[model samples]
Target: MTEVRCPLCKTVPEHGRKWDYGERTTVQCAVCGFYTITGTAVSIAERQNISHKLSAYTRDNTERGVDVPEINSNNLSQLQTSLPDYGVGDKQLLYMRALERRSKFPGSLVQVTPGIDYPLAWASGEEEFLYLLRDLLSRRLVAVPEGGTKALREDVSFETLITPAGWEYLEKHRAVSAISDQVFVAMSFSPNLQAAWEDAIRPAIVESGYKPYRIDDEPHVDRIDSKIIAEIRNSGFLVADVTEQRPGVYFEAGFALGLGLKVFWCVRSDDLEHVHFDTRQYNHIVWETEADLKEKLFYFVTSVAGKRTAT
Candidate 1:
């Protein structure tokens, strides 16, 4: 191991290390965490000036306790394209969540170094990170000890703690029924797709230990649109199949995403070309047949959402 500047953030972290293996370089960076980058990916990132976004992407994944990622040529384009564009409010909320995760207990001080940990909230750089931190402090969502701000201003490590209000804010914004046994299905109700629903989508959710609910399958006195919203809120996650290019399905999926609920995208092989340009960047499960959809959906539910616990 040798000291070197992080290929993603271009920062020479005091504790960072690098290892070379032929065409790839594995780096352990204070800002971006552990990731390996191929030579081609390095060039692309630099050329596109997306190194900051890539750093944040890697850091966010690392903070979630996932395996170290390899930013290679094959997936770099998709990875960069799929990166979420968070709004200012969302960025503030994300920063608070990061602080919450780092805190071992209530009121536990978290050591934050703007120069080293700016990617924790997807901030473009230290200046943006400090701006967000100051906003949190002004709102009384976080507290810094005396002189801590001075250290922070100097681009050094400063200890700050999440306030009680911050915890409440997170709780209010948390996704509903994250562990519910219900999985919502948003897809076209065409008779031709009945087999796909019955043999594929429904069976996949059931086999994964979750109850599948399609809004049209059950009768309700409420308006259909209102009912759909209610059911989606109660669901643990949603499976959106855009095989028919239905506008309603897209709306429902977008609504779920706005609520921070996971929405797995899927499309029939024949209809893949019709998927909207806006959502095309998502990694959709393209299926040629009902059986293939079932197998793939089942695996995705178990691996990404986790197999539901038995009652």
Candidate 2:
């Protein structure tokens, strides 16, 4: 056992180890008693450095007859692809370019300088220079031998340049960042009031200062495994319609309540009797017409936003 600095905990703490194959691996987190494969860019860089240092440390200890063994390296190449872009500017574009250009040779090596031609391709935009450098240095989770790629292309081009995953990522990034920056009061909402709830109601919810990002307008959001649940949990509030007792929407509303978020429950007048018992604790607002709905919804959202801001 050895004391290690857990990135999440930010302290040198107790750790355990196990032997897998011929390699020795350290426990992830002893205190938390759990393991998580995910990491922030900085954390990955730190762990990579730790892994390298530990390998060397093991070598030195082995020579001293301390019975130290090598740590099996985790493949971080896929994680290198791209997490969500939280930083501002074209960092993501530059990163995607780097990933697409990055090549792996024998011995599970990372080649940064091989046929990439990153520099030449990025020549049109010099601003990306800083973004590229920052990620390269900070997110150096794996060794990228510059000599392997040979150097970045001055004009290596891309096709379409706007992948569906890219667009979905951008939208999610904006929504999540907006919530963080207090740009808009982020709230979960739904307008699905009838058989047409999927159509008419959802957009209206979005238009009411609430982003229905969970319903991902673009069909591409699922591929990247975008953190939709995280976004919903971090929202300013939650609102839902129960006209048809939509199972999915009802679940979302319930989930939000469990998270302790203030909720606004609305339903169509026709199905008022069918409203479930738990949700019926609070009387659901019923709008008779589109004009009535708009006015009521506008006021409800506006009031909720006001209460949130005041607090």
What total of clashing residue pairs does each candidate reach? 0, 17
lDDT of 1 at 22: 71
Q: What is the C-alpha RMSD of each candidate to the true structure, in Å?
A: 14.8, 17.4
Clashing residue pairs found in predicted model 1: none
Q: Candidate 1: which stretches are off by over 4 Å?
A: 13-21, 176-311
Q: Local distance difference test, per candidate?
A: 0.83, 0.42
Report the C-alpha lDDT of model 1 over 103-199, residue by residue, as the tens digit. Answer: 9999899998888878877888999989888998999999998877778673688899988998988886574334357888999999989999999
